[model samples]
Target: MNRLAYQYVVLRCVPRVDREEFLNVGVVVYCQAADYLQVAWQVADDRLRALHPALDVDQVRDALGFIEGVCAGDGRGGAAAGHPVGQRFGFLKAPKSTVIQPGPVHGGVTTDPAAQLQHLLGCLVG
Candidate 1:
């Protein structure tokens, strides 16, 4: 079977960087052959509160929205959207100090990019 190239990273919510604690909250997948970059996220408010009771849910949700916007190439995506697919993926995979941060980038070959994205999300974030 023919296969396409794909890369992905898991997003984590780190309420306190000094504490070095985090919860897997989302996944970002990029399929270069398909020219697709999408983020799949399901924020568990309870989980966040469990880690840091004072954590703001709205802020976390908004961060997730920004990630989605970047994937959609919307105006809210800012300069990152104008970049090539690989560059955008690189931006997403970069580390951040905010509550939402990208994990390491993982690569694989898949016959179906969309299906592979869901599979990665289910396995890594869900």
Candidate 2:
């Protein structure tokens, strides 16, 4: 089997309230450096759930694409529901600055998405 390299971005929103609600309003862009066929959405529902307990899994799952595209700077659509209007939430300003250094993939891993994305890119180019 031919191994494929993929880059993914996961975005999320955390309400600064007592409940600590988490809204998954981000996207994951996965693509093979050589071809777009490998392109896919990693989505942020699971990540959001892992990060925050107040989020509804169903709603997060449904909004994965919208979140992913917006966060990835694809200019898809509006902000996540329930968030303040006109609030721009994303990490597209400086993607390279968010890259995480790879240490170990397993054994209580704590790899950040930006770093993972950069690592994937490096694997494709290196």
**lDDT tens readout by residue for model 2, 47-123:** 65566556666654444444444444454534432332222232221232111111111211223434454454344
Top lDDT prediction, candidate number: 1
lDDT of each: 0.88, 0.37
lDDT of 1 at 66: 88
Model 2 clash pairs?
26-67, 26-68, 27-67, 27-68, 100-115
Q: Model 1: runs farther than 4 Å from truth? A: none
Least lDDT summed over 10 consecutive residues: which range in candidate 1?
A: 75-84
Query: How many clashes in candidate 1?
Result: 0
lDDT by residue for model 1 over 1-126, one digit each (tens)? Answer: 879988899999999899999999999889988888999988889988999999998999899988887888887788888788778888999989888999888899999887887888788778
